[model samples]
Target: MQVEVLSCMRHPNMVLLLGACPEYGCLVYEYMANGSLDDCLFRRGKSPALPWQLRFRIAAEIATGLNFLHQAKPKPLVHRDLKPGNILLDRNFVSKISDVGLARLVPPTVADTVTQYRMTSTAGTFCYIDPEYQQTGMLGIKSDVYSLGIMLLQIITAKPPMGLTHQVGRSIEDGTFHEILDPAIEDWPLEHAMHFAKLALQCAEMRKKDRPDLGKVLLPELNKLRDFAEENLPMMMMFGAGFAPRNNNTYSNSAFSSSTFQVSIIFSKQQPYFFSLY
Candidate 1:
């Protein structure tokens, strides 16, 4: 199942599975130089934490990747688990969604009878899992949206998701977003930063239907923020530089397709972490 899914995926934001060896029971994937976003966000004593611009770009890159997954040619694939640990940053800090091993290709029929599938067991990291999916195992693209919501919050606050959903809820209610933000970025524009925080809060809406679509709502907002970044390039330049999409009114397929490469064998501890309860 894992091999089938990996072979079919082709997106710049998705990890390219180079090869798989049945005899050796291994899969080779393109190497990401900066390691998981987990390290960048949580590593103690690490030099110069990821700055606001890079974090903003990472959010857009991740949304672009999720948009690709949810809008694939044949069927929308759902990354059952989406979290900082599963997100890899390349040499340039471009965020790519890894761990396709636990991915589920939502069947066309599933939507028609989603409620019927409620008996299905639930599985995902505790904090990141969709509340709806947890109570009733009806999985959909919206599940990924909930997870991305938490990830966006983490990117902004440099904090973990555990208890964060509620924390942000209170922050929003009390109008104290500035208090939760990481001190490293305290100097960033307050209104702009709150706009992002507010969007993330929306994505985590308990009802999946209320959460914004990755491609339509979330991605566009991220790009608008990018446009804001472009206007304030000096802010990003203060930190290490990273990717900003080319200025164009159109979106192209090649804009997202991964460059294919070859690999015969692979061995590593950093394979996709697959977990399922059903």
Candidate 2:
């Protein structure tokens, strides 16, 4: 299932599947030097904490990949499992969505305005799974949005997701939103972070219908934060105390276009299956 889904999809922010051996059920992918966002966020390898700018950039990149998956042709795919561990980072710290093994292709329906599927079982990480989908078998693209919200909050707070929404909500209500931000990042832009926090809370809403549209509303706001990060990269470097910006290529808005992604497949007698990534 992973091969079938990955072989058909291409996006800059998505992990590139190099090859697969169906006989062994093994899949190979491009090596990510920086490992997963889980590692970076928690400094698992004694690595420095991620700068606010980088965190914002990664949030936007993950959103871009997830949006691509939801907007896939023929059928939109829902990534049932979306968490920090599944998000990888390249040498340049470019975030990419990985581990689509639990992804499902939502069956299209003409009568319904919102697309969803009824499943017998729910699959995803605790705290990260959509509450509505977990209780009910009905899964939709918004399920992924709920996970994304948890991720966004984690990116900001650098804390575990368990009961995190309520914590942030209380902090906001008590006029302590800044206090809830990750202490590792000492210089959070309070107003911008407040706006971001509000959005995250909306996405984490228990009701799926209450969530904002990922592509239409969420993506645009995240993109603004991405651009804000880019524009302030120099300042962050100078004032961010031990923070260093990478030499990554400037993020291209045109990357959302299908023309920017290309998939090439190869068949051979010896190899079970292969996909070439440029």
Candidate 3:
């Protein structure tokens, strides 16, 4: 299966194959300097809080990568396990989908036998697993769409899909969408944020047929978000101030004198008032 998948790899958005040691069952890929998006987004203190613009960019990249896989010639790949862990990022933060362990080629057979004959095998992480796939085990391109939606939600909300607060059903039911966004990003453009969130919600819909195709799921919306960000770069910069470096030791030389003067004024006011009362 690994050999077959390795041989099938041809997309530019996918991680390049370095070599595979068949004897050891090891496949080496081009090392992404930033590691997996999962590591950078969820790891405590280790992962930088991604800015809204960057998050939108990452989401767009992931969508493009998935679209290429699903639409590729000869054999369209179904990445059954599309999750943050499988999305690797380079130093520039460009995303490439990796770990095709659960990838299955869409067989050319036209019969419904493929669905009826095959035994159900759950192939993805629980949090990002397509709910339809979970129930029916009928994997298709749409399943990857669902997973990508979950990942998009993760990027926008800055919350792990399975986190206690951001659990799948609860987030939708409570309407506490802000709870999912990363705290590091204090302000996000209202239109962009709401639009992205709506798309994510559409992706996560339980009905398989209702979810948007990859083309519909990401491209148009991402382009709009990109345009919005470009137009409001100044506002984003202002909001990003907390992320900027501040020298903790750079205090004014008059700091102590200022503090003393404030204290003296307070005491002087009280002393005069007390004496007048007496």
Best by TM-score: 2
User: Please, what are the lDDT tens digits per residue for candidate 3 over residues 1-278?
Assistant: 53345444555457755555555566656667677888878755576576787677678767877876665554456788888888887656667888777777664341112321132688879988777788877777778888888888788766667642236347556876565567778777655786787787778777777887677646677757756655655654653422111112321111211212211112221112010101
User: What lDDT tens digits, residue by residue, belong to model 1 across residues 1-278?
Assistant: 55666666666777766677666667667778788888888755575777777787788878888877776545567887899998987767777888766676676466324412342678779899999989878788888899999999998888988888789779878988788887776576678888998899898999887887777678899988866766766766776665656433323323123345334445555544322322
- For residues 168-248, could you state the per-residue lDDT of candidate 2 as single tens digits? 999999999999999988888898889889999999999988999999999899889877878777755664432224334
lDDT of each: 0.74, 0.80, 0.64
Cα TM-score per model: 0.83, 0.84, 0.73
The ten-residue window of minimal lDDT in model 2 covers: 269-278
Runs with alpha carbons beyond 4 Å of true place in candidate 3: 43-45, 108-119, 163-176, 230-278
Question: Candidate 3: lDDT over CA atoms?
Answer: 0.64
Task: In model 2, state the lDDT of residue 175.
Answer: 94
- lDDT leader: 2
> RMSD in angstroms, all models?
5.1, 6.4, 21.7
Better model by TM-score, 1 or 2? Answer: 2
**Residue pairs in candidate 1 whose N, alpha carbon or C atoms collide under 3 angstroms:** none
Candidate 1's TM-score reads: 0.83
Which model, 2 or 3, shows the larger TM-score? 2
